[model samples]
Target: MSIGERIKAKRKQSKLTQTELGKLVNVSSQVISNWERGYSDPNHDDVARLAVELDCSTEYLHGISGDKLSSKDVLVAGQEINLTTEELQLFNELKKHPVMFHDLASDPEKKVKELLKMYKMKKMFLEDDEELGDGFGDLED
Candidate 1:
């Protein structure tokens, strides 16, 4: 299907009016209409928002068969990073993994931070054989 058709389908599946979807994605209803009519396409930021709001991938929105941005290609705000398509594909694969979204969603940085903290906690607990209080465990649960 065309990107327009896919967008329409996603929007409908979300049970959102054009206006509502536009609001969520920060665009005007008429802009959404134009997109549905294939008159124009969303820019990268818009596409990113659309993918998030629709729970789909930018690649999918672009009519490419794949997942969203990869982990390595993603940089913390103020960090310099560049990502190739292949890296993005790998990132998407990681994002699609069963437990990966547990980190990808919410705060991606938080996910990494929690993982590191957990690793350290695990090492400390192992050394002392003590039960650590809830931290990353609580977030996952």
Candidate 2:
């Protein structure tokens, strides 16, 4: 499907009106209408924001790919953020944990903070263990 068609489809699927989608992306409903009508396209940053708000991938929106789940983009406090490969792997793993998945779905920021803390703790432990063979320690210093 075209980018405009994909946006409209995903918006409807999410049960959001154009106005609601606009608000999430910090745009006006008219802008969304224009997008759906193929009058204009969103910029890079807004495209990223749209992907996050629509729960899809920028690649999907751009008609570059069909795999939405492969997106490493996420929304945090209304900002579009890209996940590192390690972070994406951790996130995918977290999705398998019911409690963590619920927490992440409900409050992404908190879940992200928790994940960051866990990553730091793990890194520290690895760093302190000389037998670990500088797994992440070599990257630190």
Candidate 3:
């Protein structure tokens, strides 16, 4: 399918009218109509924004893929991160893992921070045990 057709189908699937989609992408309804009709195409930036608003990957929008994998903008430390195609694939794959989304979704950075702290603590304990001699319990008390 062409990019325009893909966009139109996605827009319909999302239950958004052309005017609503146009507002989201900051374009006029006529522009959206033109795009849907294949009279013209959205520019690169518009395509990116459209993909975000539609909760889809740019590759899907560009007809380069049919993955329909979702992506969202991530902001960390005031920096916006746009995930690449590989990252989007990884995100989709993560859903299949045993990890519960609720556990990781709430305060993700905090979860990672706690994991790092636990790892450091374990490492410190291992080093201290090694310094205390390999098997103190095995020695005659």
Candidate 4:
């Protein structure tokens, strides 16, 4: 299926009108129409927003993969903003091979679970520098 077709299907499946989807993604209804009609494709950022708002994978929208969400594999979607070295390591390793992180996420050990949780927290804070406040924001990315 084409990206436009997939976008239309997912949008309808999400029960969103073209205008509503446009608003969520910060585009005009006409832009959404253009995408749905195959007149133009969404840019990377728009695709990211669309996938998030439509609750589907960017790969799915692009027709690269049929799976909307893969349970066994981890996907680091969209662009990475302000990723720390450790966060990049975890993300890149998972992208290369899902085993290590899967093991860590599924591990019942308290420290392993907490480590995963902390990574998520740190990633969230770093994405928005304002959340870190003062000197904490600039930690040698």
Candidate 5:
């Protein structure tokens, strides 16, 4: 699919109208419509914002890669942080939660730490549950 198609698909998948997405990107709905219609493209900053809002990599949005979640390590604060696709999806879900909506703006580092902790805890719980076999085998009558 083309970039415009990708953007439109992602926007719809995200359940955001063009006007809402434009507001988030600080542009008018007409601009978003233009982008969806392939009449114009967003600038670099807007593209980055769109990627974040869409919970996808810029490469996916740009149609350079078919993968919505990259498998490679990401650079943050000059450090390479490796994460699996599931972990990345968890992180994205956490970042989009209402409780975390303002955390990034107030303190991104703290938010990252918190998200990492949550991800680890979640992974551990899932592992433990799997080991327990249906998570109800230990229940007593």
Candidate 6:
């Protein structure tokens, strides 16, 4: 499915309106609408945010691959987030390949999408800054 379709699906599953998601991701509601309609594509920053927020990867957002990480994999990757004990237990039970978890507190689909957006945004932002330099590179010249 397209990113727009994926976003709409996740948003509905999470019970969040486009405006709500836009607020969380620091975008306008219209921006979300535009993205969902394919009227515009998200910039790298937005894509990153969306991926983390969606708990997928930029590649997944771009539809490069449809393989989603299992809940345990998501939890493992999210170790730094300091998930709750319940969350950890849930992940532990769900981490094996062909992953499945019963009674997840959060909808895995939406949770993964959101997490992916945050992860992608953070990684992309840092990479972009590094590539652009600190803007003080010529200060000594």
Indicate which candidate wins on TM-score.
Answer: 4
All models: lDDT?
0.70, 0.79, 0.73, 0.73, 0.77, 0.67
For 25-72, candidate 2 gives per-residue lDDT tens digits of 999999999999899989999899999898897878999777564456
lDDT of 6 by residue, 1-141 (tens): 888877777677668899998998899999999999988888899888877776666666778768544333443232323354555454444455333333435565555445445555777899999998986677654
What TM-score goes with each of the models? 0.51, 0.53, 0.52, 0.55, 0.54, 0.49
After superposing candidate 6 on the true structure, give the runs of residues whose Cα lies further than 4 Å from its correct spot. 74-141
Residue 67 lDDT in candidate 4: 62
Considering TM-score, which of the candidate structures 3 and 6 is the better prediction for this target? 3
**lDDT (10s digit) by residue, model 5, range 23-127:** 998999999999999998888899899998987888788887687864444534434456667656676677566664353555455566678787789889999
Per-residue CA lDDT of candidate 3, range 1-141, in tens?
Answer: 888998999999999999999999999999999998899999999999988888787778888766676454443233334455654344445446544334655566555345445555777899999888866457555
- lDDT for each residue of candidate 4 in 1-141, tens digit (9 for 90 to 100): 889999999999889999999999999999999999999999999999998898777888999878685322334223213344564466555456445444433333443335456767877788877755675555675
The full ranking of all candidates by TM-score, starting with the best, is 4, 5, 2, 3, 1, 6
**On residues 1-141, what C-alpha lDDT tens digit does candidate 1 reach at each position?**
777888898899889999999999889999999999999888899988998898776777898754433334455332323445554554455545556345354556665445545555666778665455443455643
Q: Best-fitting candidate, measured by lDDT?
A: 2
Worst 10 residues of 6 by lDDT: 71-80
Relative to the unseen true structure, what is the C-alpha lDDT of residue 9 in candidate 1, on a scale of 0 to 100? 85
